[model samples]
Target: MAVTPGEETLGSRYRSLRDLVLEELRDQIIERRLAPGERLVERDLAEVLDVSRIVVREAIQQLAAEGMVTVLPRRGAQVAALDPDSALHLFEVRIGLESMAATAAAERRTDVDLARLDRLIVEAQEATRAGDRKRATHLNMEFHEAVVDAAGNPLLGSIFRSLSGRALQLFRIGQDVDAHGLHHEHVELVAVLRAGDAERAGAMMAEHIAGSREGTIERVRQLVAEAEAREARG
Candidate 1:
């Protein structure tokens, strides 16, 4: 529960303490700086962030509602563990939403959007080549998110925000997945986006997501089994 640098800077800039706390806590969970199933003590996090317990509790509750945190009767609130069923359900929703996002992005994307995509693709390639799975996974999440933002569909972005945390957690669990293949698919998606072929972009996004499912489901199952085994041991 260590406070990262620049948080005090954020406090100064943001007028809403609760919003800031929510953002920070959510980022920690998504980034796995806060590990899955780890207890989130309000007193501890509140002291760390120099905020009130009310604020931290509010943030945790919001995360709970988003399914990023789980609250048990006696266990309090801990980071949520990903289950294979949740991943499969999430894949179904992402397939529909992200494919729509790609199609809309292809129609609405500007030169600025393309520039950001190009930069991310290059960085992702570098991370993959270096075998930096953590950074590569983060960049992969960023790439899809950028396309959603570029789509100019506020509702779509809202839905993505709701799911992005668990989606990131799932990606992290797939650390052993082929990084090069993921980056290659990203490049292919960008090519379609660059050409503004809406239908092709949509189909490409669907296929890209399906490929990720294929690569990642086994790892998801493995993690689930490991977690269950650990619980059994206890």
Candidate 2:
């Protein structure tokens, strides 16, 4: 049973043009087609995306609200700068939310949840083995979202959804991580989750997320400076 992710496109059956444009812009940023700190010129984007400037503006505003885009004093909109304070805050919320979600998932998860977790891990591990950190990272985030879904709380799911894009950006900044270690930890988490040990699941999730904190701020500082330098050279 193959899942068709469906034909999602600007010209396809999205609810609105804004929604399509928003996703297109987001994908570009995440894929580095739109680099960090790069200005998002509305007219250029509109022309490239073959949409109206108003649609691009609306999409940019939504991204601003999501913290994926920032409006500078002199600049209109750019991909959000890699700020250390914001990264730390993101981890704080992620650790707390994911810890709680894992705990609840351990207690409430259905067999379906277990199946989904297993599948995500398999795909993620395969991606890791293939040296496709980008795909692995995407799957890893999906793994977290699956845990939140298994938590059986709609509000938690929504909050996690809102934070995921920002989280993905940070993960991209740190994707040069130990792929094998990540796969091993994910394997362990699934085992604990399957065993329904709420306390263990919560602790493991916190520790796993916190693993990224060591030197991450410094790395982000280096990466941001490098990106700024690149922009300057252009």
By summed lDDT, the worst window of 10 consecutive residues in model 1 runs over 2-11
lDDT of 1: 0.85
TM per model? Answer: 0.84, 0.87
lDDT (tens digit, per residue) of candidate 2 on 1-234 = 111133443645546899888877877777777777788988877766667899999999989988899998887899887778888999999999999999999999999999999999999988888988888889988999999999999999999998988888777778877777887898999899999999999999999999987567677888778877887999
The lDDT leader among the candidates is: 2
Estimate candidate 2's alpha-carbon lDDT, on a 0 to 1 scale: 0.85
Which portions of model 2 show Cα errors greater than 4 Å? 1-9, 12-16, 72-74, 228-234
Candidate 2's TM-score reads: 0.87
Model 1 residue 114 CA deviation in Å: 0.8
- Residue pairs clashing in model 1 are none
Q: Which stretches of model 1 miss by more than 4 angstroms?
A: 1-24, 27-35, 73-75
